[model samples]
Target chain A: MILKNKDVLGLEELSAEEILGVLEIASRFRAVFDRPVRSVPIMRGRTVVNFFHEPSTRTRISFELAEKRLSADIVNFSTATSSFSKGETLRDTAENLAAMKIDMLIIRHSSPGAAHYLAKVLECSVINAGDGAHEHPTQGLLDIMTMQQRFGDLRGKKVTIIGDIAHSRVARSNIWGLNKLGAEVTLCGPPTMVPGGLARLGVNIEFDLKKAVAGADVLNVLRIQLERHSSKSFPSNREYHRMYGITEDVVRTLKPEAIVMHPGPMNRDVEISSEVADGPRQVILDQVANGVAVRMALIYLLSGGDPGALGVGQD
Target chain B: MEWSWQRIPSEFLVTGVKLCRQGKLGKRKGFLHVRKGRIEGLGIGTPTVEGIPALDGDGLVCGPGFVDLHAHFREPGHEEKETVATGSRAAAAGGYTSVVTMPNTDPAIDNTGMIRYLIDRGKEAGLCRIHPTGAVSPGRDGQGMTEFGDMVNAGAVGFTDDGSPIASGGLMSNALKYADVLGVPIITHAEDRSIVGKGCMHSGYWSARLGMAGMARAGEDAAVFRDIELAKAAGAHLHVAHVSTKGAVEIIRRAKNEGLRVTAEATPHHFSLDHSRCRDYSPLFKVNPPLREPDDVNAVADGLADGTLDCIATDHAPHTVTEKEHQFDQAPFGVVGLETALGVGITYLVNTGVMDMGQLVQCMSETPARIFNLPGGRLEEGAEADFVLFDPACQWVVDADGFQSRSRNSAYLGETLTGRVSATFRGGRLTWRDGG
Candidate 1:
């Protein structure tokens, strides 16, 4: 199965078979990560531009590293360094990049519909990095890949995404991916931060941190994103940590062998303790490594490239 | 005391004689002086009327201008929908001397700065007195409360999370308590999320028949019930917004009978129309706390007549043409109300003899001011001169194109109405004059 060269704007557009095909390709790429010669010439001549209007070091670096590993020419355009400072509109910048013959454009903007807008306007295949606290599809795919690599299969495995969910694009996208893979995903956060109607999305929601993370096969901790905090959300970061943080002591409360993961640049000492990020049960580094392979799979799948030789796609 | 008699034409005399010192000179006769536009003088005996424009008093009656407890002047962001100036002009032409604007704008009025900005804009318009309601939550997000004390200090007449229900019980209770401390009311757009599941119109035969999602009456009733209990717990006041259900009316009636500090308001659409009007799948009939059944409309009218309902609020939500032109469920919920409220009230309530003109004035003016604790609701001697001159019998067809509101989404367009405003005065100045 191959994805049409259109926008992967949301998870709702993907069929179960298409998602499995992407995952299969990601699994093959995951195996390549262990070898000494890990680079692939999948998108050798393709120019991938990482255009991030929002701040995220980990996501940007992951995409850059993923493109480099795929041998694609990459240009990282941070909002700070771009013509956005010169009052260039998002459409103008995207058109400029498209005119430069960029084959695949990965965009992250602070507005919710920014990616969809770019996808509609630009001729190249557009991948959404993150859009204002909405779905982060690539991060979600990477998370599922991490889980699938560790557990062999995710059918009926329990995964808990813990922390500020209302503002986490990661949790939303992960919920879509995890549920598609037949994982029981529980979203836990302070009531103010966790979105209502998660049950409508076929996910369990809990306010009690201990109960939410208990007996989970995987725990994905989301950062508290201090800049997104309005006055109404919480009294203080210390208070938030006291109630909801995934500290080492809190990790001890989880299923003993459950892997702990954080979409990094973690708010260590706030949302997740540094001890857990470096602990024996932690696969946070594996997530970073798998990030490239998963993104490469997405880029190849969406760019009309075949992973058939690796036995990833049926046709 | 001595007295003199004079005769004048029927149309120009706008006065109501309040008896002073009964049995003096046979009857308690007082003359009201109207000079230019302001009330120049009033005398009890030997009418010493000077160079003031005095008109005849024959079969006409006069009262203070009406005020609306709710309106939406969708300006600043969606001006293609409604502007403050046009909305205020519409209010004035609808016999409204003042209107309380809901705070669900593009950027919600969650702070004193936004409140001041709206007030300044209203002032610049120089029409009806625009008293803005501040949002109870930041951006009306419903997670927590905005600075109620600060909003109150900045002259927000009331607080509400209109266009969105405050889903959290804790937040609603806290807001009520905060408003209680500040001696203000937290007006609620009472619709429970659990019951209102993306509904477009009132749940009834029409909704089931048309296959459109229906906003159940349970939605409004459930929230009204919950908020009443929460208000009791917090010992605070909760004003139900756009009360459209009989069940909600019953709850508000019982709460008021229990001596709870509670008030409820109904929109003109609720008492004048029902769900059957939505059979055409018209977007104008779509409203949050949607138009209920005919029985509910009657119950609402009864509630208003018997003092169960405190005021008639015009939930005057305005949407752009593009926003309202979608399919029934997809289009926004609301229709323009500020300009149509008085005509609807007169045509439905007054003409039907269900409620007299005095009761209509009470609901639209006196009671709204009393409920919100505003100052200008009376036509007394020293009171600020805010009044409306309306032809009580003039019938006109509603036309959106001819409306002063920026948005042309009134559900009542083409509906025949019995009364129309001839002029409006705010603070003794003629702010709006029809056919001027």
Candidate 2:
């Protein structure tokens, strides 16, 4: 079955079969990255724009690399260089881009529903890179891909996400994707950083770091956004690390085979210890590698490339 | 003449309408004889007057013109959004004859001259009465008090720092005490800034799921509690604007039970719409004290039914289309409500069995009038004629382009509502007629 939706806005909108369909296609794209020549002509004539309204390092470059590998024409726009700095609104910018007949727009914005808004207003396919505390579908898919590589089927697997859950788009997207895959998910953070209302979404809310880390098949550690703490969500970075950080001692609580994941630019010793972030149990780099594959698969499917054709010419 | 619109016949007979006044609809169809700009005669049955113009009001409900305790005209500064003239036309279209304009303008209405300017503009428009409220602080900075007595003498109905809360409790208490001496209520745009930092919508399941910053209900409830306490201590009248949370309603309910002079008003959006409307992240649904959950919606409706909420205020805030076109987090907070308030009230409140039609009219007209101590809440003889004729069951979809207001940023745009105002009259002159 094909991916039915035109936009990959969020995992929440995707069904289980649709998600599994994306993962299966993404694994084929992952194989292409290992070839001597990584580039493909699947999207040769397609034009995709990387519209980043928020500052980013990894997500923007990952998407650009994916577009280049797929042989798609790419134009980049950031808030600093775009007409948006001169008061041109999102609608005007979108309309202008539509006028150019671009094939897809991968948007990273600071507004939670910016991607959803563009998806409604634009005719071309829309991909959400990251929207303020909202969903990062590609990141979610890549994290899921990393997990699937370790454990074939995620059903009944314990996945604990620990960090500033209140402000993490990564956490939200992972929660939706994991929940749909039948994984038992637990969220661990300070009460201020975690909203209890999320418990209604069929996830566990645990404040204790050790209890949450124990028996977890995977731990997705989100960055503690220090800039968002003007309201004092936690006392200090030191205090947060001591209380909820995934240190060497805390990592020992997990099973010997359990993995740790991070969507980085890591905070070093903030949310995760430097040792755990670089250790064998951590697959953070693998997650990043999978991000490019996941994005390539999405752009291909949204461009109407057949999933059956994805297996062709890979030998 | 400034009153050129009033140059109709000296007397007229309104026939075959159900008259609602002081929270009751007349048992039979009635006639109202308006003479010399006053209700010369009003009762059940056909009037035996000869050679007088008769206005047919068949299948229509006539009630006192609605009085709004909160609205933002955006004149003398942001006329691109709205002016007194345009806002009056919109108000008249929505069956309102008297509106209390909020003081959060470019240069706020802090002095007597600004108040007079609004009053004169309303007179020039000749559509509705504009009662301006002076800012509680000079610039609404929440630092110092304005000249409440001087502005009140120059026709200000009340005082408020409406766009933002008075952050200091001591300042709020002092303003309440000062306004109490002038016998005017100190209206508060109740919200705690610290708790509401950068929050654009209600903090709940939708917020958690959407991943946007959520404005917790405690921000509103805490501010309402503080203001009520300050009002109680000052022994003054305090009116809460846009009561959206159930906790705030319960707080106001208890304050009234204690016989403290606390009154509150709910907006049409608060009682009808909820946070789910913000799912699309459209700036149209973004408002201060953002649309809450279903429980809060029901509580606001219940508050209006039980007199915990004293009136229905439109809170008709208008912003430019360009302004509303921004991202939801970047867009200004407001929705133009003057044209859809009555329809929303009927569709959400009356049709849901939350309150009867007469009670709705009373909340819109009489209660608001009495709360602000304004005139023209009744259709009694010798009183100047001020009333609205509406088809209570008429269904019409809201189209923003058809609005009389200058701005098109309305929350109810494209929504099919259950009631429609056909005409409005003030001082025996027709101010607005539907499809005109």
Candidate 3:
């Protein structure tokens, strides 16, 4: 089935079937990576613009590589390089881009609803790379894809997200996507960093880090956003590491088959230790690998490519 | 330009209208006899006096014109959004005859001269009575106090640092004490800036789900708590502005029960809308004290019904379209409410059975007038003929384009409302008529 939406703003708006459909397509795209000629002509002639109002490294390159592999023409705009620095409003820039008749506009803004705002103004498809602490839909899908690769079925899986759940858009998107896929989601963080209101979203909030990771099927660790001004929530890096950090001791509390995940760039020893970063059961790199496929699937589907018809011509 | 307070002497009889007055709706259709600029007589039935032009009110409900205790007439500064003239026109269109404008202007209305300038501008417009509020601090900087006595003498009805909270407790206590001496309410914007730092919307499930920074309800609550204690210590009237959280309502309710001079006002948007309205990321919904959860909406509505909230103030803030067009986080914190306040009251309160029309009118008109101790909330013999005619059942959609205010940044834009104001009159002269 083709994706019904003109924009992939967030995972919160998508249905379970729609999410699985994108993941299914992503699995097929994931296989294409093994081939010598990984490039596909699915998005041929379509122009995609990567508009990063905020700084990024992994999500941008992953999307760029996804666009290249899908054969879509790509143009990149970062805050330092774009006319945005010249005091052009997002609407003004979006209007100019719409004037150029681009196919899809991928935005990464520091504001929460920046992507949603542009999607309403532009006739073209819009993908949210990361909007404030809101959602990173493709990242969510990639994380979900990585989990499904390990456990196959997420139903009844205890996925514990530990860190600044209050400010993590990755945690939000994952909560929505994982809850839709019937995963039992538990949030673990310091009291100040974990908002109890999220419990209304049908997730359990656990303040104790050990109790949160205990017998968990998957542990998705979030980075301590020292830059996002969340430093006031906890005392220091040493205190946070001592209290909630995912060290080897914390990882050993999990079930033998349970895996650990972190949406990078990890704060090294702050949120997760180096031993756990390079340790077994941590699928951090696999998450990065799946990100391209997930983004490629979304771009292909939102570009009106048929999900059922993938690999038919190229195979 | 020449400005005159004197209106053309007029004689008219408003007949066949349901009159709402003194916390009750008249059982029989009545007629109001207006001579010169005051109500000559008003009672149930036809007037004995003849030779006066008679206006057919039809099935419309006539009540004392609404008095807004809070509005931002962006004048002497941000004229691109709203001037005193345009804001007064909007007030008249919304069936308001008197509006208390907030002091958070370009230069901040902290001085006596600025207060007089706004009153003169209102008279120049010849639409509504404009009562300017003085800022608590000279620049609303939450620092030292403004000269309350001089500002009040210059026709300032109240004092507030409304766009931003009076962050310091000592300064707030001093402002309240000084305002008490001047017999004016110190209107607080009621937010703890430290708690609400960078939060664009209500801190709750939606903020968590949307991934935006949440403005915790504790901010408003803690600020209200502090302000109420300060008012108690100062023996002053603390009028809480835009009381959004249930915690704020409870605090105010307890303070009122203890008989501290605390009067509070809730906005139409706060009572009717919720944080879910921000789901679209529309800056229109990005109000300060941000549209709260449904429970808070119910609490506000209940607070108004039970008199914990003393009045319904529009907090009629206006911003330019381009300014509001920015992303939600970057957009200004307010929605234009001058034109939509009455309709929202009727639609959300009266029609929903939360309160009857008389109570709603009392909240909008009489209580607001009493809260700030303003004139013209009563329709009685030998009083200035400041009143409004509105059809309680008239269903129409709100169009911001049709607003008389310079800006179209209304939260109720495109909403279907059950009431429509037909006409407004101040000082026996027609200020606004439906089709005109």
Best by TM-score: 2
Provide the lDDT at A49 for model 1. 88
What is the DockQ score, from 0 to 1, of model 3? 0.58
Residues A140-251 of candidate 3: C-alpha lDDT, one tens digit per residue = 9999999999999899999999999888899989999999999999999999888888898999999998888888999999988897654388889899999999999888
lDDT of 2 at B259: 100
lDDT of 2 at B247: 100
Better of 1 and 2 by DockQ: 2
Model 1 chain A weakest 10-residue run by lDDT: A80-89
Fnat, model 2, is 0.69
Q: Which stretches of candidate 3 lie over 4 Å from their true place?
A: A80-86, A306-315, B1-9
Model 2 over residues B108-154: C-alpha lDDT tens digits? 99999999999999999998888999999998999999999999999
Docking class of 2: medium
Candidate 1 lDDT, B132-199, residue by residue in tens = 99999998898888888888888898899898889999999999998898988999888887677756
lDDT of 1 by residue, A100-218 (tens): 98888898876555677678778888999887556788888778778877897898999998887766778878877777778899999887666554566788888998899888999
CAPRI verdict on model 1?
Answer: incorrect
Q: Rank the candidates by TM-score, best first.
A: 2, 3, 1
Q: What's model 2's TM-score?
A: 0.97
